[model samples]
Target: MSALDIFENDSDDTKSAIMRATYHALCEHGYANLTIQRIGDEFAKSKSLLYHHYDSKDELLVDFLEFVLEKFKADIPAEEYDDPCAHLREVLDHVVPPTLDAERYEFTSAMIELRAQAPHDEAYREQFSRNDRFFRQQFADVVRDGVETGAFRDVDPEQAAALLVTTINGSMLERVTTDDAEDAIRATRRELDAYIDSHLLAESGE
Candidate 1:
């Protein structure tokens, strides 16, 4: 399943409904044009529920940010493989891939749009910052695990993690902006693979 699948069938009905509605709105209108009214339109049965809970679109979107992040974290597979490096590769496969499907592309595009607002909005800034740190640490942990388990060469985990995160973000930003997004995304995956080979993997293993 794609990354967006993680957010599906949430247990909390109200939050689930709101998050689903928000997703629909964001995909249709984008962050710049998004409004609580548009989101409520998606929740046609109880539009007033949205208004009752959230006074503003910004506040609701911020909650949506947290909800998305939590679902993302929950979706990450926890199983350990025989090869730490293989598992690390799998993690990157899921985390860094650029829009393998329409939903992923739309969700990522909306996120980038939201990120643009973070600079001026403290709530947005804080939530995005937390998400960034969380994923960076996840990446770093994978790298550190690889090194510790003899699956990778000794490397600075944090630096490697930062590099991966930056590469993925840049590629995603480029992907959403250009028409030849698939080509750009493929090139990015290739470059990231090359970088991992050159800097992270032990020569004997590959």
Candidate 2:
């Protein structure tokens, strides 16, 4: 039984398999060294099947990036949190790696490597632009919701959103350069908490 068969769609299953293989290849081989042959090692089927679908590694990687971004967007907790403040917090937490799991680190490192290519590759640039805009809008929307619902103080949603996203990105970059990232991640979370308390939420100390 194929992983995509779980979705009850054959075409989707094949595409998903290809993407899974690509992700495995990416994580195993950094963007600088990734090849279609490497990805085939992770694929369940023959390498020829991949070549049949994609003429080159770059083409496959770009499509793989799109697949991963779409999955990331879909995974956002849309209505799980009880309030907008909690929802916004969850979103921030989601962006920053919470644990030092090896797999997560490898995956994130690969993504950052790919993101670094955005400047030189038009396809990558466009996809990353879309990803950035989506999260910015999502953060702004959550902040707007909180303010409108009286859960948070009235603030410029766009500015607050930018701060949150930028901080997350900064933390990711810092993580790449350090062996132990727990301290940095904790400090960021603390700062974010303070920011939420001071800027978004009303004073509640009695």
Candidate 3:
């Protein structure tokens, strides 16, 4: 599911609506041009409701980031796969998809724009740091499982996870900043798959 889909399952309908509106607005206008008025234009409720909750655009966005982070954690399929190799592939695909459609590309570009503010915004920095740690731990957990099941070579799970996470971050940055995003993504996928085959997958698993 798309990241925005998580808002649909929220218990609080108002908050859910707001988040969905914020997502669409961010995707449409981007981080630089995003405004409370623009978000309210997407929102079905009164604009005063948005102002009632947030004093400024940054305040609303920080809360939006937190909401996104929680929803993202809930969406992780950590227990969905019995095979370690398949689980690893699933994780990799989620982070770096094979294709970049228009909607997804726009969303990713907006998110990267938000990420660029991390150096200046402590809240954004903290949220992103938590996100990174969570994803890295997911990778580490799968690697540990693989090792225990003898499906992967005995490797330091933390180190392997770190490498994979770093690769994913770099690939995402390249996708947003570079013109040749598709080719770059393809190259990243190729190298990452090769890394998995040579470093993680055992002969039996392969």
Candidate 4:
């Protein structure tokens, strides 16, 4: 079996189709409008067929956000550096965005919508938080490894990792209301680099 053999199946394709239809529905008509009928209509399928893949609206929401999270992981290129700081700088290239694409903007809006509804829907909050934690773990692994080696300056990898994630999240929030997101994000990026240097860089080390 090749690398993709694990995810290579007709069933997976159908499920993916269902999820894509659901995502488009979510984007075009917000979460409140995302009903079984809407997704079924989007895919030119029956409600029963869509329901076979997803049990409830909440289940579909979980799957949809999970799908977006998976895509986010794929879109974020590995920095490909041993040094934690340098690799983080590579990620900083994308995360602290004034340079985001429409796709990223859509994803951010979906996330905000999901967050806003979290209180009313307990399951969504739990699933979304779990998926978010998993995503953050991806960065922590790199930071920890970099710190262990001489590549990164000795400091709190956990805090450093959190800073990176939070800044991206906050910047997205800032983006929607601001007139010029790119200019604000550029300024934010410079401040973030300085913050990292203050907290993580070692005094007498590489």
Candidate 5:
């Protein structure tokens, strides 16, 4: 599902609406040019409602980031996959998709812009750090499962997870900022698969 789809089933209708509006506004105006007015334009409710909740654009965006993070955690069906290799491949695909359509491209670009602010913004940094930890742990857990099942070669799960996460993050940044994004993503996918084959999968399992 698209990340924005999370807002569709949100329990708090008002907050969901506002979050969705903020997402669209960010996509259109981008991080540098976004403002309350732009978000309000996309919101169906009164502009005053936005002011009632958040005094500043950054304040609302911080909450928006939290909302996205929570919904993202819920969206992942990591436990549903019975096979560790399948689970790992699914996670990799989610991070580095086979294709980047317009919507995905726009959303990813906006998110990368938010990430760029992490060094200077404590709140952004904290949220991103939390997200990074969550992803790393998810990967490590899957690797550990694979090792226990003898589906993968004996390896340090934490180190393997760290390497995969770093590679995915770097690929995402390049995909959003560079002109040769398609080529970069294609190359990333090939290398990731090769890594899995050589370093992760057990010979018998493969």
Candidate 6:
């Protein structure tokens, strides 16, 4: 029996299988091509089964995206830095190794495609916007804390947050699929460090 057929639409097992099938479908096919027909075929079940669990392909896709996004959020190490730049080190430490590994590089392409096409789907666009804002806010909160603690160089944390996010997003095109990204990430950090340090540090010693 197909994985979907095993769900058999009776208990929680079916719901769980639907989610699993959706994720496998997304990783293999991406959001644009994923369909109820494909999902049903995979399960040797009817398209109606998916609809019973999810309203539409978009709904399933959103669920899949949320699953991956949650995993990404969970992998982030606890914040150890009071300063934003040091917080940046936490991000780099977490992001750098996976950037080089093709097998583990699952989040980049799908995220890029969704972010780029969000404008076309009103609901998807809103959800994407919400996620973007939350990410920025979290980053800004860390930066702001940095300023209050005398760890970060004094600057507009909001602007710094935007710049920091932009830097990471831009790097995705080059780094996510690359074999060598250490130099690029390092250079970007240096420029950012100079911009921030000159303002935050004591001139006499730092």
> What would the TM-scores of all predictions be?
0.91, 0.87, 0.92, 0.77, 0.93, 0.69
What's model 4's lDDT at 192?
83
As for candidate 5, its clashing pairs are none
Count of residue pairs whose backbone atoms collide, per candidate? 0, 0, 0, 0, 0, 2
What is the per-residue lDDT of model 4 for residues 1-206, given as tens digits with 9 covering 90 to 100?
Answer: 11122222324466677776776676677666668788787775556877777778878887776665665665555556656677778667755645656655665666677778888888788877876586478678877786777555776667776777788777877775567877988998999888767766555444
- Give model 5's TM-score versus the native structure: 0.93
What TM-score would you give candidate 1 relative to the actual structure?
A: 0.91
lDDT of 1 at 75: 76
Better of 1 and 2 by lDDT: 1
Ranking of all candidate structures by their TM-score, best first: 5, 3, 1, 2, 4, 6
Angstrom error at residue 158, model 2: 1.4
How far in Å is the alpha carbon of 187 misplaced in model 1?
1.8
Model 2: residues >4 Å from true position, as ranges? 1-12, 78-80
> Across residues 1-206, which tens digit of lDDT does each residue of candidate 5 receive?
35656766666589888999998898888889999999999999999999899998888888888888888888876445568888888778877885777767888888899999889999999988988888889889999989998989899999999998898889889988889887878888888889898889899735
Error of 6 at 14 (Å): 6.5
- TM-score: the better of candidates 1 and 3: 3
Which parts of model 5 are misplaced by more than 4 Å?
8-12
Off by over 4 Å in 6: 1-20, 37-49, 67-84, 96-98, 175-186, 193-206
lDDT of 3 by residue, 1-206 (tens): 36656765567578888988998899899999999999999999898999999888888888888888888877765455678888888778877886777777788888889889899999889888988898789889889999998989999999999999898888878888888877888888988889898888898624
User: Weakest 10 consecutive residues, lDDT, candidate 5?
Assistant: 1-10
By lDDT, the better pick of 2 and 4 is 2
All candidates: CA RMSD (Å): 2.1, 4.1, 1.9, 4.9, 1.8, 6.7
Could you tell which candidate, 1 or 6, scores higher by lDDT? Answer: 1
Tell me which of candidates 2 and 5 scores higher on lDDT. Answer: 5
* lDDT, each prediction: 0.82, 0.76, 0.85, 0.68, 0.85, 0.61
**Candidate 2: residue pairs that collide:** none
lDDT of 1: 0.82
